[model samples]
Target: MSQLTTHILDTSAGIPAPGIAVTLFVLQEKEWLQLAAGITNSDGRVNNLWEEGSSLPHGLYKLHFDTQEYFERNFTASFFPFVEIAFYINSHAHYHVPLLLSPFAYSTYRGS
Candidate 1:
């Protein structure tokens, strides 16, 4: 498992948000460097954003969820074009960031 991971749950639809694009970035100097990107599977999880057992340096990181395309594909109007969550990783601990989403709203939190 990568040190970092994420999943999306479409609360409005009461199911996993499959096929959503998730991107990972690391802050280098003053730029956000693209680290990895993947589309969610049927379970809404991207488990291969990085090589299994890979460790990342402690720094600022961000996850971008492409919400607009997801909503468009399902023919649902959404409020936000996309969702960006910036977080800090201070150790090699596994980080699970999950998103709870709806058409007009979304929420995220640090997960186990």
Candidate 2:
């Protein structure tokens, strides 16, 4: 079993992306269900999406980041209103999903 966590970096600004809304979802059958939600802290990290130290069951998961609001607040133009990264969890290691974001582009990967 493993728990989920995430962070966002504004690649264009070279800083942590603060205050962005992030949500975690699990795919069940054909529907996606929200499991946890949180806004990024000043450090752009959300480590406690669920209970700390508790493990999530193995399944397909998604991380949704609200980029539109972040860019709007910063008075910057953006191409993506939001971003979603979906991946599989089938191991016993902790999951760290990180987002590298810019106004017109973004990327994500399994992190440490």
Candidate 3:
């Protein structure tokens, strides 16, 4: 299994926000380097953002979620075009980043 994974839930519709583009990045010095990209499945999950059984160097990381396109596809008005969650990885522990989203607002926490 990958050490990193993510999912998104649309609070407004009470369903997984599928088909949204997501990008993973790691901070090196002052630049954000793209690591991998995946789209949300029907369950709003991307479980292979990083290679399985491999270790990631301790650093700052980010996940960029494309929200505007998701809302447009569903014909809804959204306040934020996208959401970026930046977090630090200091150990080799499993990381789960989850997004709780609405058209007008969103929140994320460091999940298990």
Candidate 4:
């Protein structure tokens, strides 16, 4: 079975971006449909974006992070209201998407 997970690190504060909302979507036929949603935990991770025994089909997927709310709660000014990471998941393997975030910038990559 395949699994999907994510982590969000607040680079500016040097901590996990806890309680931040994240939504997962699958692109199908030119439209995006919500597959799962989770909030970052104390460790700045969402370990189970998908069910344990479930697997996602090979396709394009996206992770949307609500950076505005996170920044607002921390009383910081942000240039990006939100961050969206779109990537391809092509096999029955675990996908770890980690986000390195700051008030003004963010980056994401495929992790082990």
Candidate 5:
């Protein structure tokens, strides 16, 4: 588990989107600094984005999901090469961001 976590569901296939690469970045003084990166597991979850119980500085953060490779792996044509979700982390509370994706479209939101 981590202070921040994520999962992806392939809405088109109705299954967990495994093997996708996900990256986390924190807004620095003037640029984005990489925080962590991980590949989704069989259940489409990345629970190690950061150390569990670690103190995460409150700031703007981003989650970049690699969609091109995932689409290519399944031989599907996709409109977006990748998906980036920017959010704010302002507290110690757990943050779960989940993505619902398909070949041509995607949606995401804060999750429990």
Candidate 6:
């Protein structure tokens, strides 16, 4: 079955974006319903956002990153108030979404 996971890296600091808040949501008919939310660990990873053995339905999903709070705590300024990523899940494999972020820019891609 399909599984969901995520990781965050702070490019500006050249380290993992620890303690950052992340929220996962599934898009329904006309609204986005929250599925799970958690803060990143020291390694900046939420490897199991969903319950183990649970499978997600194939559709569009979103991940919200609380960049502002993370930056403020470290005495940094960020251009993007928040970061949101929308992606499609289409198989019974693990989806690893990794965020590489700086103060003014960020990038993400499907990871292994």
Provide the RMSD of all predictions against the true structure, rounded to 1 decimal: 0.7, 1.6, 0.6, 1.3, 0.7, 1.5
In candidate 6, stretches whose alpha carbon ends up further than 4 angstroms from where it belongs are none
**TM-scores, in order shown?**
0.97, 0.95, 0.98, 0.96, 0.97, 0.95
Ranking by lDDT: 3, 5, 1, 4, 2, 6
Q: Rate the local accuracy (lDDT) of all candidates.
A: 0.93, 0.91, 0.95, 0.92, 0.94, 0.90
What residue pairs are clashing in model 3? none
lDDT of 1 by residue, 31-67 (tens): 9999999999999999888778779889999999999
TM-score of 1: 0.97
Single out the weakest 10-residue window by summed lDDT for candidate 3: 47-56
Residue-wise lDDT of candidate 6 within 1-112, one digit each (tens)? Answer: 2288889999988999999889999899979999999889999998778887988889999999988999999999889878999999887788989999999999999998
For candidate 4, lDDT tens digit of each residue in 1-112?
2399999999989999999899999999999999999999999999988999888999999999988998899899999998999999999999999999998788888999
Q: Per-residue lDDT for 15 in model 2?
A: 99
At residue 17, give the lDDT of candidate 4: 92
Deviation (Å) of 40 in candidate 4: 0.5
Give the CA lDDT, 0 to 100, for residue 40 in model 4.
94
* Cα-based RMSD of candidate 2: 1.6
Clashes of each: 0, 0, 0, 0, 0, 0
- Evaluate model 5: give its lDDT: 0.94
- Tell me the lDDT of model 4 at 27: 98
* Model 4: CA > 4 A from native: none
lDDT of 2: 0.91
**Model 4, residue 36: what's the lDDT?**
94
Q: Please give the TM-score that candidate 2 achieves against the real structure.
A: 0.95
Q: What is the lDDT of residue 17 in candidate 6?
A: 90
lDDT of 2 at 13: 98
